[model samples]
Target: MKSKNTMFLVQAATIGAIYVVLTLLFAPLSYGEVQVRFSEALTILPYFTPAAIPGLFVGCILSNLLGGAIPVDIIFGSIATLIGAVFTYKLRGSSKWLAPLPPIVANTVIVPFVLYYGYGVNLPIPLMMLTVGAGEVISCGIFGMIVLTALSKVKGSVFGKASYSK
Candidate 1:
């Protein structure tokens, strides 16, 4: 029991740290209107374990903070990630293709507001939504699917049979 809990913590921490590193490494393309945070590919991790919910939330917060995001972005962006991850975990049993929808929708719906009001961007809300949604499609939809595929192939070897229940 203790070992299980430890493993969960370790996985979450590792995911969060990787997210931060990816975001920082691709700092320029990780934020803003036309952006694709490659770390978002990991959003699909929640489909494998509940640990990814908080892992993604904390990671987004840290990434935004260290990347010099405004307070609104730090708060709302993290909230978006939290919402996405929770939904992804909840919807995991539905379908593999559906796993990335929550995060994509959450970011699409929420990020435009942050960019317009929070950052004082001049783009129209609809346009901002389009851009953000496009980016999410690239990161969460495309890259996330890629990650899911790779993870599925090695689930038994990497995450154990417990994660294969889905």
Candidate 2:
């Protein structure tokens, strides 16, 4: 039991660190209107382990801090990721194809407002949604699907049997 808990913590921390590092690597592209955060690809991890929820949330918070986000973006943006991770965890057992939808949807819905109000972008809401959603689709959907496929092969080694709660 103790070892299992330790493993869970280690996995979560490692995921968080990876997320922060990836976000930092793409800082310039990640902060702007057309954000293609490579880190968003990790959002699919919740499909394999509940630990991914806190992992992704903390990672988003840390990434936002490092990215020098505004206060509203820091608060609300993290909230969006938290919500998305929770949704992903809930849908963990359904299908791998559905895993990345939570983050993509969450970011799509929330980020448009953040761009318009927080960043003071003058674009229309529909345009913001399209752009942000497209970014998420590419990052969380396309790249994330590729990652999910690769991770699925290693799920047993990384997350263990009970990790797939479905």
Candidate 3:
């Protein structure tokens, strides 16, 4: 039982670290209105492990902070990630294809307003929404799905059957 708890902590920490590193590595494309955050792909991990919820939330918060985002963007963006991760975990019993939807939708709907009110960007809200949505689709929808597929193949080795909840 102690070893099981240790695995959960290690997994969550590793996921969060990967997310932060990915965002920083792609700093140029990880922020702004028109952006594709590669870290968004990890949002799908919740489909396998509940640890992904807090992992993603903490990662987004750290990424936003290091990326020099405003307070509103940091707070709301982290909240958006939290919401998405929760929904993804909840939808785990459904089709694997559906796991990424929450992050894509949450960011698409929330980020435009952040760009407008939070950062005071002059771009029209609708346009920002479109751009952010497209980025999310690429990151969360396309890339996330690919990540999920790849992870599925190696899940038993990487995560062990006991790592995930039934």
Candidate 4:
């Protein structure tokens, strides 16, 4: 494979690994109907690099899988992350504040259904949306913004080129 491709794969894999770590580290708050997954903050990374798109998706997948999520949650939850990451990438040149909105909205909308049908959580969809939305706001909006701001400073250095030195 070319150096660029290799670098891209490495970046994506690293992001996925980090996502798994964060989700597992915060196991209690990383699952269930009311979850504040700290890993969701990494969803903002798509704004910096396209590699983050796949990275976040695969990361969510492994996180859910290892977190013992049900089949529906594993599939749908990852899809939400993937959709959010794609939109985030599309909005890369737009306002940074909007970067986190996609994941927040995606998760808020999709996760409630996963909770209700997948986990058999007994809660009104709207209520679940509210709770999930709140979590997303905390994770994706607030925490993601913190990460985004810090990453923006090192955007060129970190997301730029691979040294290709081995």
Best by TM-score: 1
In model 4, what are the clashing residue pairs, if there are any? Answer: none
lDDT of each: 0.89, 0.87, 0.91, 0.90
Which ranges of candidate 3 are over 4 A from the true structure? 162-166
* lDDT (Cα, tens digit) per residue for candidate 3, span 1-166: 9998898888889899999999999999999999999999999999988878888999999999999999999999999889999999989888888889999999999989999999899999999989999999999999999999898878878766723323
Clashes of each: 0, 0, 0, 0
TM-score of each: 0.96, 0.94, 0.95, 0.95
Q: Encode model 1's per-residue lDDT on 106-145: one tens digit a residue.
A: 9999999999999999999999899999999999999999
Worst lDDT 10-window in candidate 1: 157-166
lDDT of 4: 0.90
Candidate 1, TM-score vs. the true structure?
A: 0.96
**What does candidate 4's lDDT look like per residue over 42-87, in tens digits?**
9998888889889999999999999899999999999999999999
